[model samples]
Target: MADRFHEGLRSQVAFVTHTRDYRSAEVLPSLARHGFTTTERPHDRETERLLAQFDPDLVVLAIDPRHDDDIALVRQVARACKAQIIVVAPGPHPHGLALALEAGADVCVRDTDGGEMFNAQLGAILRRKTSPIEQEAEDDGPSTITVRDLVLDFDRCQAVRNGESIPLTPTEFKILAYLAKNAGKVVSPVEILRAVQDYTYSEREAQEIVKVYIRRIRRKVELDPAEPSYIVNVRGFGYMLERRSNRRDAVRASEAA
Candidate 1:
């Protein structure tokens, strides 16, 4: 496919990938036609050096998420520079995408997502970066909300359940707060996406991406993620979090007696 030259991709591109041959032919030509000045790096080890040398407006990292260290490399790149960051791999792995996002990549795309899709994701992140994420703005409220054993302290930026801290990415924290604020009520993924991302998503894309973050939240907050109690999936709709009733306490007391 011919690259459509968009102003967004026309900015400088720093392409970092472990496998130089993986879709390089396709990626490079598209980037070139888009007017992006490209510099390629095989390893993220000297991400700081590369960023300084290239001074790119966009950083693209192609990696295999199956490798744990590769995920960490995304973190290194994300933290090392202010350039709009994109983590583009050759395939789809929701977990990797989520991890890359949690680590602070501005966007994640498929390596084959030609210049057009690349341009769109870049634009969204560019917009998202300019504004304060919804949760951060809302943090001016009570600062803490405690429900049964689960507590979210916006001031401390922490979520605790059963006395253990449930580590959350900024976006995950926003989703949790929004859901917990309306505990027991179903909230559509579109609502959550708009609130957390500041960008609306199509229904299809909203459902899948929100599910990834919800699953991540469940892993941290639920004792058995296989049967989640914290974030209940509302079939064909959205999600809900059922507040544990005092009935469970009474049952426990009776069993102890």
Candidate 2:
């Protein structure tokens, strides 16, 4: 019965990674047992052509975050196709996970989670993609949210600030749009993950992931990221976005006082 169930999924999965040992010894075997058709590559060389040929249901990326180019690889795969992405990193690195997700990865998995958990995560994502409700949601076209001069264009998955275009990954835009929709309110990291990522993490883990993305967002949006006037931290509570016009005015007022 289990074999039949696995066969029914008929999932086409691919792994793009430089770390071949872990993937070959563990992940690929597990995927095989689950009846998924699989492919593997050491890097994104000729990735577009291969991706188009495979037309996979999911793409797994195993990378070391310290290599700056790994993040770029994720962005490249994201632009290449609509396949859901899962990034597998070596260990418990929250910042790495945040970077992967922000670069358009659908989910980030730590390799320490082992093959069983990895297989389970992939299976869950496949189920969600095949879900009827999820399909309906994807059918809806993009929309826009205007928060003063910060305009979030969901169609293009980018932001425009005072007529200047700022490119953002889909996940980054979601986090920002969530904060904008609830402007002037403090939003906890856990709340943001639940609403945007559709998953829950421990408060500590969520904080680590959300803070990195917030810092990145500030760099792109704030005139002086070091002393931000737009997104403000609420101390031990959470973060809030101040929706006042001309945020520089607030900075000047504080400096004058």
Which candidate should be chosen as best, given TM-score against the real structure?
2
lDDT of residue 117 for candidate 2 = 69
Q: Which stretches of candidate 2 lie over 4 Å from their true place?
A: 1-15, 23-38, 44-59, 66-85, 95-106, 112-142, 246-257
* Model 2 Cα lDDT, one tens digit per residue, 79-177: 887777878888788878878766767777777877766777766554543333344456544467777688887556578999999866555667888
Clashes of 1: 0
Clashes of each: 0, 0
Which residue pairs in candidate 1 have backbone atoms (N, alpha carbon, C) closer than 3 angstroms, thus clashing? none
Which 10-residue window in model 1 sums to the lowest lDDT? 248-257
For model 2, give the RMSD to the true fold: 6.3
Writing each residue's lDDT as its tens digit, candidate 1 over 184-254 gives 68789899877765666667667767777777788788777876666777667788766874323322232
- Stretches of candidate 1 off by over 4 Å are 1-40, 44-86, 89-140, 246-257
The lDDT for every candidate, in the order shown, is: 0.66, 0.71
